[model samples]
Target chain A: MASPGPHSRFSARVGGTPASISEAAGQVMAIAEAHGYDKAARFAVRLAVEEALTNALRHGHKGLDPGTPVALDVEMLPDAMRIVVEDQGPGFDPAGVPDPTLDENLNRPCGRGLMLIRAYMTEVRHNQRGNRIEMTYQRPAP
Target chain B: MPSPESRLRVSQDAGVTLVEFVDRNILDEANIQQIGEEISGIIETRPQPRLLISFANVDHLSSAALGTLITINNKVRNKGGQLRLANIDPQIYDVFVITRLNKLFNIHADTSAAMSSFQ
Candidate 1:
């Protein structure tokens, strides 16, 4: 992996396991901050990346070979940063996820990843594979 | 065997000190303060730029835990160190992200990566 510079960007390949996802998140955060992103922006990127990666591990690649790896591609733009998380597991319908805040599901222990991703990032979308999630955050305007 | 509550334990691991709570209820304010103090004390004594925390046994964390994490993160950074979380259950990880805390601290998948942070 290339070290993040003033305009640093890098990509890392990690296994699609819950354990690896968290490790990957830390690596990404370090790179972002090393590239000069402010604290708030760094936090946003980390949260989004973590959530997306978790989804890939738990949902995207749920029962497949534990050895399957997830690909994390990150790019730091001048005004925004983008991350793409791809998994080889069976894809699902993104729209099927329920709103966590809904009265019925409010007390449930799961189903909040999407909400968190939406809250922390400026943009979030699922790719055709349905197993790939793309999240983007634009630095707060000065 | 003993009662379920009796089976629950909270031990302090020196390598990556963690307070494991087995209950599912939300953490209250008082507990947060106590945990923060312990974490602070760890930082004061170790003087390491990074600390690894595990939430493996904690099933649910309250907003109080979130606040404690923020306080710890700030204090660690002020001292030129960092606090990293590890083994956070998927459910708890969701809470961190939803509350936007997953960003505030450096979180790792397990203790090894967090400990390796200083290298």
Candidate 2:
């Protein structure tokens, strides 16, 4: 087995069963806190992570069998934290998501996560298949 | 339905039911469900359910929590009642803004303001 590096590292495979997002978020938050993320930063990371996982579960895995795997990887670096959430289901187009902030869609609940993820994270990117999302949050300078 | 043991505090002011969520952070899915059920119960039992959910101490909420609030809001309106929110943290309020729930619910700066608006 390869030895783990000095930097903080976390990896988990969350089962696709119902209500797994909460558990995934909890674990991510714990890892963030362990690396000295402040309350606000932790909150942002937690929210973004939850939304990403939920999207994977709700949109990516639709019509698929339960127990599909949602892979999680977290790397705490000196300047930032990087997280990758990937699912085994079909991907989506990030740009095609409607703007929830528009007057017509203001009352609707859709697109909230997309907005939040963009707002909180320093950078957010999706794989070509759209089934995988990568989010990065820059650690606040002391 | 969420049981009384959920530790949700209830108070009345200006005929408005102010629900103080015990969990300072409404992130867990189970907690979100419990709060949703509690709000639903309030909507069903209150003759004129003008509710003001106080998030004074709550600093964090998940998207599922947002969905729960939407469901409760619909139930309150369908029951011929009203639902508002007050004392939400700025960060949490931003969630409402991003989700555009700010336009859907009557949000107040504080519980006092929310109560007065109901009068």
Candidate 3:
């Protein structure tokens, strides 16, 4: 197939460790820079991805082996990026997550990861199992 | 004065403790935890700590880091201290805005403004 205008894809079974998360996020961001995504977009994608991976290992893989690896998929397009993160742990209801923006919850730490992932990504979808998430960010057409 | 293990550069100006990040990205678990512990240690050193955390060097931060900040804010408030964040990059500041943490924390444009508002 002919080049699709800086199209690129990366997939990995990333470890649950912090170093692994950083490495994976860095790779995704390097592609973002190479594809000419602006700082804001890179920040958004990085934050969302980090939150997703951390949540996967911390919450999804809870009580399981700490060495469990989560699935990460990144597709960098000319004007957008799509990312998916899936963990082996049982998934929970995204609706059940309390709103961190609420007055009562504002002072409380934790629970902002999913909220952020939603806010930054153009679109977010969770698999029926809830263990898998697919997020997309589409840049405005110039 | 920052310890070798610290992710923050800590100092005092007047009565306020000015804290800056040594790392460009505060997005990971270990880094955020260490930063939290270091700031919390500062908070514990004084009865009424006036802390100004500047994000001049932080290029990215995750929600976990935000959680750590909240924890620090709680500790500061519990001890009658104050916490102010300054010099946040516009992109990173949007993370605060998106999560509505701007309402939860006292944020300022720069260190000078944050330090002045300490009292």
Candidate 4:
């Protein structure tokens, strides 16, 4: 399928892991503001994007060469903003994640990222490539 | 990079207290706890217990950060006040919603609205 139109109406690109994650987030907020999203909605989008990017950077590219690239794509519509984060690394099983809220895992430092991603976005899915993930934010009713 | 430190600013009229985080990485769980302990200290002292976090300088956040916010919100609510959020960077906000926290806290567009929420 063809990509969404330039006016349909959002997009951005970033290279590398850490900086790419930050830039991806900045792009999402800029798009939200341009579309006049409410504060709560904007916050939700930002958090979801951050978690996805962090996963890409931390887990996806944990020990890869620093030269490896991570890419972020964002599209904003009238009612929602969709984000995609792709990385160059071996993908892992999303199903194997432990429950973050469990008492045994509560004090652990890193398990909650995926849990937070699932909680905030209206939809969260991983692509077959395993290194690519997509998330969406729906505009809350006024 | 600046070392992690916690700062608190009070806004009584808005019934919201703003906690600004200047940390190496808000994504770190230990940093989240340090920040949370400071905010909790403030809430423990306040008679009304209202809060609105302004994460203006915070660049990133992790699930621990989200949990810290939730814990603060519960503390404030138990005291008959509310915990809201403002000036959150998009990166951190995304985590908030992805974790379904947007549904739990009264996040505002700016400090003004978050403060006014208690009225």
Q: In model 4, how large is the Cα lDDT of residue A130?
A: 88
Considering only N, C-alpha and C atoms within 3 Å, which residue pairs clash in candidate 3? none
Candidate 3 ranges with C-alpha deviation above 4 Å:
A1-7
**Tens digit per residue, CA lDDT, model 2, B92-115:** 998887677888889999988888
lDDT of each: 0.67, 0.80, 0.88, 0.69
Off by over 4 Å in 2: A1-6, A17-20
Q: All candidates' TM-scores? A: 0.56, 0.86, 0.94, 0.58
The digit string of per-residue lDDT tens for model 3 on A22-48 reads: 988888878787788887788888888
Best by DockQ: 3
lDDT of 2 at A81: 90
Candidate 3: global Cα-lDDT?
0.88
TM-score of 3: 0.94
True A-B contacts kept by model 1: 0.06
- In model 3, state the lDDT of residue B62: 87
Interface RMSD of each: 10.7, 2.6, 0.8, 5.9
For model 4, what is the C-alpha lDDT against the true structure? 0.69
lDDT of 4 at B17: 59
Question: Candidate 3: which docking quality band?
Answer: high
